[model samples]
Target: MISARNFLHFSRGVALAAAVCFFAATLAVAQTDALPSWNDTAPKQAIISFVEKVTKPDSADFVPEAERIAVFDNDGTLWVEHPIYTQLAFALDRVKSLAPQHPEWKETQPFKAVLEGDMKALAASGEKGLVELIMTTHAGMTTSDFQKIVIDWLASARDPKFKRPYTELVYQPMIELLAYLRANGFKTFIVSGGGVELMRPWAEKVYGIPPEQVVGSSIKTEFRMEDDTPTLFRLPEVNFIDDKAGKPVGINQQIGRRPIAAFGNSDGDLQMLQWTTMAGGPARLGVLIHHTDAAREYAYDRDTEFGRLDKALDAAAITGWTVVDMKADWKQVFKD
Candidate 1:
């Protein structure tokens, strides 16, 4: 009963609606692809399978939301840690800023080495000298003042190689993984060798991790009354080094429960991974982000100074840990 012209118009409207619906469905699928930066490789498949198994309510490997703890190493695991650690870079820069105050530092061995950019001399200065550098720059300030200093430094400091803010150097794929895990009812925590205060300032904004959820090395702090105000002053004293064996200790002290999944990049994280995945009651997930993409990011393992991956690399194979080859496994490195 319709006219020919009216029928043609109706057909056109139906075609347009179908096109819109198809486009929308395509977009939805694209948006839901959790780790778009990760290639469809063994590592990616392993991650998806593990997540599915644990998240599925009917599956035997299912973990309840309360017990879904995931711990991550900060430096080379989540962000770039090459040439030197971000915290160490901050300390070196601080030495230059404070050199004016201490005129004797110009002739001092370790301080002089840092000032002259003499890597050999700095290395010769040994652990004692390194401790001296950290103490001089990191101490003598209140907690609040130190936090402000760190915040200010992070805002201005740029990674020498990338020429971008250090925070921006964080891996896009890892960020996606973190989000994916959290979406699947996992509580993510940052367990790093970096100073707790150094990471707490920006971790929430950058990694979606809260300050209290961060566990790391700490310097001694003293409570004092400053001008009728209570303040906690940072001291030049070592509290704990959350690396290697200390990682497990830090995890226990901070998280109070054993994590079912752990992620790391270097030998320093081996103990944490072992504690998490090898404890072995049920299915567990351990992932190591192997930096193999020299073109996109730095490629160094087994002999790297910053993130030495010798022992852990060996352990991964024997323990069935997922070693993510950045070159082959990741579609991208940093986020745009």
Candidate 2:
């Protein structure tokens, strides 16, 4: 007969194995708690419940992979948008770099202000100044040339306030949520007010959203040939402004069908969430990422010079969109 001591040793081995299994299971659950990071509000529950119902093969609410459309705004929603928009800074930097070539820019109203580092004067010019800055530096070149310039600049560009790569400054929670949704068969797209071409050049590398999946503000362009060389040059004109009401129009123009899910963080995205949720769907979801932590990320609304969030807040309540308080919802904002 086996000794009682040997039997006890076998029992101890089995107990240790069971303990390891239990610990492993707990770790797995913790890692998969992406939705748990969200608040317990009705809007948050709606998203979690919908995702569960759709992913279950036996459920009547199961949505096919092709029908899962998720759209996200880029600025305040996906990354930081305080003090100023990153693209505007990009345009200003471009003005400074290209100013030497175009000496007339020294006399130009907005470009001259940007060159002289007179932000107060630039803002006083208001919308007219903002538009002039975008047009002068963003346009007037081949799309390929513009793309190359953005790529090269981004390599060295760091957020002036945070001192991190503008790309690295993206919200960590959103990045995790994006990957989780994609793993469950959701196709993600970025619908931002920023220039489409500007986003397309680096979005695939940064966010994993291919150029074809991006929809944003765009300028008009024409295909042409210059002495046996084919080229596509940007026009000094506006094609569409993908903000507020324009967001829905741009989505319809590009994505065709209404998205079942949408995310935004400002008045610029109010119409986008409205369109996403009001499209006669039983399982549509909308989320808004609110910047509330002034210490971690700058916070301002309505009267703020950039990324005014007041109108969007009103719409959030009316439309039942999930407004994620940055201070409460996310444990960390950036990788840094």
Each model's RMSD to truth, in Å? 5.8, 6.0
Best-fitting candidate, scored by TM-score: 1
Residue-by-residue lDDT tens digits, candidate 2, 21-140: 999989997786775445556545666787888778887777788988899999988887766888998998998888889999888788778888998888887898888888888889
The lDDT for every candidate, in the order shown, is 0.94, 0.85
Q: Count backbone overlaps in model 1.
A: 0
Model 1 lDDT, residue 236, Cα:
93
Q: How do all models score by TM-score?
A: 0.91, 0.87
Worst 10 residues of 1 by lDDT: 27-36
- Candidate 1: give the clashing pairs: none
lDDT of 1 by residue, 46-165 (tens): 998999999999999999999999999999999999879999999999999988998999999899999999989999999999999999999999999999999999999999999999
Candidate 1: which stretches are off by over 4 Å? 1-31
